[model samples]
Target: MRQLILLCSLPLLVGCATTKTGLAPEDVSAASAKGDDVIWTDAASVEAQCNAALEAGRAVRDTIVRESASDQDVIRGFDNLSLAIDETYGWTQLMFSVHPDKVIREAAQGCEKSLSKFLNDVSLDRALYEAAGGVDGEQLEGLAKRVHEHQMRDFRRSGVSKNEETRARLAELHAEMVELGQSFQKNVLADVRSVKITDAGRLNGLPQDFIDAHAPDDDGTITLTTNYPDFFPIQTYAQDSALRKDLYEQFMQRAYPANGEVLLSLLKKRHEYATLLGYPSWAAYVTEDKMIGSAEATDAFIGQIASIARPRMEADLKLLLKRKQQDDPKADAIQVWDRFYYVGKVREADFGFDSRTVRPYFPYEQVRTGILDLYGELFGLRFVQDKDADVWHESVEAFDVYTGEQHVARFFLDMHPREGKYQHAAMFPIQTGLEDGRMPIAALVCNFPDPSKGDGKALMEHKQVVTYFHEFGHLIHHLLATRGDYVKLAGINVEWDFVEAPSQILEEWAWDTDVLQRFAKHVDTGEPIPAEMVKKMRDAEEFGLGANVMRQVFYTAYSFYLHHRDPTSLVLDDYTDEIFRDFSPYPRFDGSYVYANFGHLIGYSAIYYTYQWSLAISKDLFTRFQSAGLLDPVVAKHYRESILEPGGTRDAADLVRTFLERESNLDAYKKWLTE
Candidate 1:
């Protein structure tokens, strides 16, 4: 998701927009387009073109209002204003992370501030909000009405009806929050840490290739960082308790003290802004715009599941305790670092499977083909890489998405770790689709394994393979899906809670035996992962799953409590320790800044609960796939039309109901948890 709900400019009403919802295809390119052909050779050229478009948008907006443009014309003007800022700024933000040039990155940071201020002004404009007077919403239909209603709703949430002084203050707060959020992410990237493994004995359980990748220090020690590929392998395999503890502490302590104050400050401003917007708290403020409708409702939803899941979580913990006690008679308690360690042991003891067992058959190239081929087979689409296409980095690849003969979108793939790339997996929207011919562009930024590990061939763990499928689910959603009004109803624009359904449903394919056998093959032998092995692996995958789901419950509760309560009472560490300990099956570790590593605390805020909330819906969706057959084109087509294609044009519940032909329930989710 772009997450520019606040940064994006909403439609400013005029008679023009209501009367002329759109232009003829021929008229759009000649009479109305701006900033569509942005050249990226230099920052100066980009800035000048963007500024010109901004000026043009302003002039056209003035004319539309002055001339009392029709409804259709007003919508067009709003779209133009949005595209000018979005097409220019969106690409600039994408380049900031992936572009190799530091100068361009710096320029992007500066431009982001400028764009933030501009967006704040638009959101706070009294004249624009007044022009967009409240409507019964019966006059328009489809995306046009969605855009109209959302525009008015956005203005209200942005405090457009508030007095000028208060509105101005809110605008300032919005700008500050953007800078704080950027700084929060930058701190994480800037604060990388590592520890050296001084003894070979400490690396006893790790794979040879993993050990070989690191250049031994002069003292013959292997240095490892907090990056996922390195960090996860260590936790999954390392036999030495001391070494695991060292790595865990270093990883958990990232972005603290540096981001501690930043997080605190961000929450403060958010509370103030939300307060000014007439909400009692930021949770309420954010929830008003989401499908859940209220903070209390979201809490009740989480509580309902937590009540059923607690005992299941406790049962899973007994297995962890049994394994820990077997390792040492004196080991009565599981520490934070011991969860993965003990879980790995218990998994091997019970299921005869581990990540290392299947890594051989799940090499990088095959995984990519398997995902693309599966999507192509089911969705009637093709993904073609333009090796020569201009991109921000050497590793970044450009590809076009097509449904049969029609090209729908372009996406860039930057799927490996680097010195300063974004550390998580997400689909960044570069440009949004429009009915006016501006095609959508998106980028999938992930820190999946690269050549640094071994042989320059990335072999994903089964979990990583699922992650790949999950993130690409978001990408295909952005590409295959189209909305009439692109701004309000484009890719990943559904309710925050519902956005994960498409991706989570796709993840189930990774666990399916038929799907795995279709493309998962050994790098050396070209043999598909054995059905027997995959079956065991699939069952083993659920080992301790209840505890894992409970962990999400903890994260959601911690975040919700922090935002929904008084900000003055927040002591970042104490609040985390208290709430996190409630759901954690083990004791809290010392000096652990787990909150700092949680990017959602900054971006997701109250919506962290959405992952679990969406998972319930995701599970329900996969039941349809399971019954219909994994590769059934008819079911896939129905999902595309009913779930993925509608975008934000309809409410998420409505979309799900239309797809399932009945109201959704948590029965599938409960079955998943109990199974």
Candidate 2:
């Protein structure tokens, strides 16, 4: 969420702005608003579509296997087969996620296992597997070759060559894993709880804007949910320490005691799956295809970073202790709830600045416009609003991306959190670009405070603004590329550890003073944030780097322990609490099962180290921009072509080498650690 550096300048060939309504006359005529059912339907309909896709895929495979087909024909058949099943599944999952209806989501879930099992069966088909392996990847070039190569590896990894008994077990394991992940995610999303606070006077340090935004009930109590926009302000600024503790505990225990069992089951299955695949652990299996190459490597990297981060964290803890003592003579320890509150106090005292002062300068619309425009200016891309396209929600918007006159990609922006919405910020790819005139589409889902809750415009905190930049980088990574094969070179198909680099790189833009001035403006006065305040903001960002780094280290370690250790012997609370005592400044709260709600256990698995690992790469890449200039089109284009466009066509390390014209070093990363 923090750390960025920049330099340079560029020329703009195209400059255009969209209407606030984001619709033109033609768009209005053609535009059809959509609801949840537009993409999501009953289980029967979804089952039928999945069956058709499976049937169609096999027919393509059968034709290739039976006919004396040329290389071109064989490649086309595979592409067609993949498109049928993949696009259908992608559509269903996307719809199910954004749809508000519980029935639709349940239907999607009901069909997921059956459909996935069928597809995995096809992936393990010996005829198709041999056909793919027989193709010479070097002879075919681009998408065709890459697709063949990837398919061959995938077929082997799917255990297509295994005996019937073992293969069946593998398939069962795959299906069970998918269900566990789905159930865990569902539990998190369905969890809705709010705490009602009655004492209005107790909200002393909180901004009036926050208090007014959440209207009190007839009994004069305000309800607080775990949404970032609403929750974070109170965590940071509220005077009532007890209330903050209550909220933090609830937030930590989300998806809860139930999910703890779910998580353990998942870990056990993952370990068994890895053992079946001839690996020591799931961490090793997952990292085999990533930059680090093994669990041992990742562990070493974590240790290297932790060594740098620990001392800085100790200093931060000392500073917090000093501040706590000032507030109370008897105060001796800093708890998790007290961390942000004291950090806020230190910023006010040290910098004479408040985050609220900066928030007014960044009205959501203007900030978004600025971010998009900045990207367009540097990247040679233009975005045309497709306001009339069918979307899951009214607040969701669509835009087609272009390079000159040719449409390159399209993306959806679901920028606000709502009831039954996906809570975390992420980029979800709908369709990735292929060489055969097919364009890519992606979604950027986030939970920025909805401006409509209070005013029609949201004033974003600097951190939230950074999250926008980060997530947009991901969308750009997904939308801006084409590969020889749709499945192989499509956006974000790269190694998980390196995939975060693009988005992480753009977060620097948020920290850029020149960039901030371009879009950050006061909703009331139209004045940009002062340069002096910008410097203060930048300086204040390093206030507690140690504590934050320690937290990440713990998360990374905790995940590793679950996947690599003996799950039967490991107790989740005991493992996490001990780690907290060792690395964290605060004592662990009793009965808190933070790991249960940690979505990474479901999605990221043992790959949480990627966040820190990618940050190193991001910092290295940012240094390239720092030297060449942040706005340098030559540098930006180099990044786009070398890093973004390659997708997964080349090794991630090779891509970095090509862009940097040298091997990436951790000097930039280590420097940032202590800074």
**Count of backbone collisions in candidate 2:** 7
lDDT of 2 by residue, 1-675 (tens): 383211000000000000000111111111111111135446677677656656666666676676587777666666566555544555555655666666766666555445555555667778877777666777997657766765665666667877888888887887799899989988877775567888787678888888788777898888898767766887898888888888888777788887988888888888888888788888888777678888899888877877877888789888988998887779878888898899889878987776767888888889889989998998999998897887767888888888999877888888898787766676766665655456777777787867677987788888889988888897888777676555545667777678778888898999889989999988899988789888989878878777777777777776765677757676877788777766566778875677778877776788778778888899898898999789999999999999998887788899999999999988898788776
Give the candidate number with the greatest lDDT.
Answer: 2
TM-score of each: 0.86, 0.83
Model 2 steric clash pairs: 7-629, 7-630, 8-629, 142-484, 143-484, 143-485, 313-546
Per-residue lDDT value at 436 in model 2:
47
Question: Which regions of candidate 1 deviate over 4 angstroms?
Answer: 1-39, 134-138, 175-234, 246-265, 384-398, 414-424, 435-438, 447-458, 570-574, 589-597
Off by over 4 Å in 2: 1-52, 67-77, 99-118, 133-146, 179-204, 207-234, 240-243, 246-261, 387-396, 416-420, 447-455
Instruction: Report the poorest 10 consecutive residues by lDDT, candidate 1.
Output: 7-16
